[model samples]
Target: MTHPEAHKSHRAGWLRAAVLGANDGIVSTASLIIGIATASATQEYILLAGIAGLVAGAMSMAAGEYVSVSSQADTENADLAIEKKALENDFESELDELTEIYQTRGLESGLAKQVAQQLMAHDALGAHAKDELGITDTTSAKPLQAAFYSAVTFTIGAALPLSLAWAIPGHLLVISVAVSSLFFLALLGGIAAKIGGASITAGALRVTVWGALAMSITAVVGNFFGVATQ
Candidate 1:
C-alpha cells in the first residue's frame, strides 16, 4: 500500500530563520535608506547607511540564530542523555514507559507493547527519542545550518534595497526604495508561505503591511529631523 503525502513541517526550522532574516534585511535596509534620503542626506550617506545596516543586521541574525539553536540542541542532547541513563539503569521500566506512550497515542495495549518491544529491540534510544522526546531526525536543530542560512539570506535581501538606493536618482530615491522593498517583502513572504504550505496571500500581505508601516514611520521621523536641523 502507498502512503499519503506528507506535510512540510520538516522545513519549519530553517524556513523560519531564513524568512525572518530576509524580511528584516529588506525592510530595515530600505527603511534606513528612505529615512536618510528624507533627511536630505547625500547619496553617499544613504548608501553608507544601507551598507552598514546590511552588515550589522546580517551579523546579528547569524549570531542570534546560532546561540538560540545551539541552546535548543543542547537541551535535546541533555534530555537524550537522561533517557539513555534511565534506560541503562532500568530497561523494563523504560520499555513499559514506551508502551504506555504508544497506547496513549491510540494503539491497543497489547499492540502498543508489541510495537514498543520491536522498536526498542531495533533501536531503544531512537524509539524513545522519537516517541517520548518528540525529537525526530527532521526536526533536530542544527546551529551552524541555521546561522549560515540566516546570514546569507539576510545579506541577499538587504542587497536588493541597497542596490536600488545606489542606482535610483536622488529625486526618486525614497519612493523607489519604498516600493521596491515592499515588493520584495511580499514576494519573499508569499514564497515562504507557499513552501511552508500556508496561505500565500496572508503571508504576503502581512509582511508588506509591516514594511510599509516601518518605512512610513522612519520617513516621517527623518523629515521632521531634517526640517528641525534646517
Candidate 2:
C-alpha cells in the first residue's frame, strides 16, 4: 500500500473504534432520550436525562471495552510466553509438531518437511509460534486505548442531537433530533466505508436506511402512547 493508504489503515483502528463507539452512542442515547421524552415532555427533565445518559453511557462503553480488550491481551501474552518456553525446552519435538501442522494444511509430505526444515532454520521460534500456536498475525487487546476512543466518540455522537434539541424550538424538538441523527448516521457510514476501503454509497445507504427504520419504529411507539394517554 501507498503511504497515504497505510496512514489510513493505521487510522483504520481509530475509525473502527469511532464507528463502534458512535453507533452505540447514537442508538442507545436516542432510545434513552425518546423513552424519557415519552415519560415527560418537560424540557428540563429531557435535558437532564440526556446529560445523565451521556455520562453514564460513555463510562459504560469505556469500562466495558477496556475490561474486554485487556482480558484478550492478557490471554495472548500468556499463550506467547508458554510457546516461548516450549521452544526453549524441547526444540526437536516442537519442530516435528510444526511439521504436522503444515501437513494438515495440505502440503505434501516431502514439501511439508522441507517447509518445516527451512522455516526452522530461518526462525524456529516464529515457525512454531505460527503453526503450532496459531498466533501469527498478532492483535493485542488495547483495552485502555479502546476505552478512551469509545468514550470520546460516544460523547461526540450523543451531544449532537442533544444540542439540536436545546437550540431548536421545544415544539420541534423530536423532529430535529430525528433529522439530525439520520444525517449523522449517513455521514458516519460514509466515513466508515472510506476508512475500510469499501463503497461509500452502499455504506451510506444501508446505515441511513436502518436509522430511518429505527426512528420510525420509535415514532410509532411514541404516537401510540401519546394517543392512548390522552
Candidate 3:
C-alpha cells in the first residue's frame, strides 16, 4: 500500500479537522436555534439565543482548537530539542539507533547500516526526526493557522442556519433551519470523507446521526418547557 506521504496527507488531514470542527459548530448551534424556535418562543428571544450561541460556540471552538494545536506543537518542539541534543553529544549512539531502526523497517543489516550512515552524513537530524521520532517532511503543526481557519469556517457555517431562522417566520422558520442545516452537515461530511480517502456513507451517517440526536433532544426540551409555562 502506498504510504500516502505527508505533502498530500497534510492537506487532507487539515481539511478533515477543519470540516469536523466547523460542522460540529454549525450543526450544534443551528440545532440550538431550532430547538428554541420550536419552543414557540418569540422571535426576539429566539434571535438573541441564536446570536449568543453563535458567538459562544465560535469563540469556544477557536480557543479549544488553539489549545489542542498548541499542545501538539509543544510536543513536536520538545522532540526536536531532545533529538538535537542527542545528535550533538551522543552522535555515535544516535547513529547506531537510527541504523537499527532502518533494519527493523525492512533493510538488511549491512544495507541498513550503510543507508543510515549516508542519511546521517547528509542530514542526521532530519533522518532521525522522520524515521525515529515520527515527525516528517510535511506534517509539522501550526497552531495559529489552525485556530484561525477553524474559527472563521465555523462562524460562516453557523451563520447559514441562524440567518435563515431570523429571516423567516413562525413554525416554518424552524423547519427551514433544520432541513437546511442537515443538508449542509451531510454535504460537509461527504466532501471531507472523500478528501481523506474514507467512506462517504460512513461520514454522512456519523454526522447525520449526531445532528439528529442534538436537534431531537433540544426540541423535546423546548417543547416541554413551552408546555410547562403555558
Best by lDDT: 1
User: lDDT of candidate 2?
Assistant: 0.77
List, residue by residue over 94-114, the lDDT tens digit for candidate 3: 989998998888999999999
Q: Give model 1's TM-score versus the native structure.
A: 0.96
Per-candidate local distance difference test: 0.94, 0.77, 0.83
lDDT score of residue 173 within candidate 3:
84
Ranking by lDDT: 1, 3, 2
Residue pairs in collision within model 1? none
For every model shown, the clashing-pair count is 0, 0, 0
How many Å off is the CA of 146 in candidate 2?
1.1
Candidate 2 error regions (>4 Å): 1-13, 38-40, 100-127, 130-138, 221-230
Against the correct fold, how does model 2 do in TM-score? Answer: 0.79
137, model 1: CA deviation in Å?
1.2
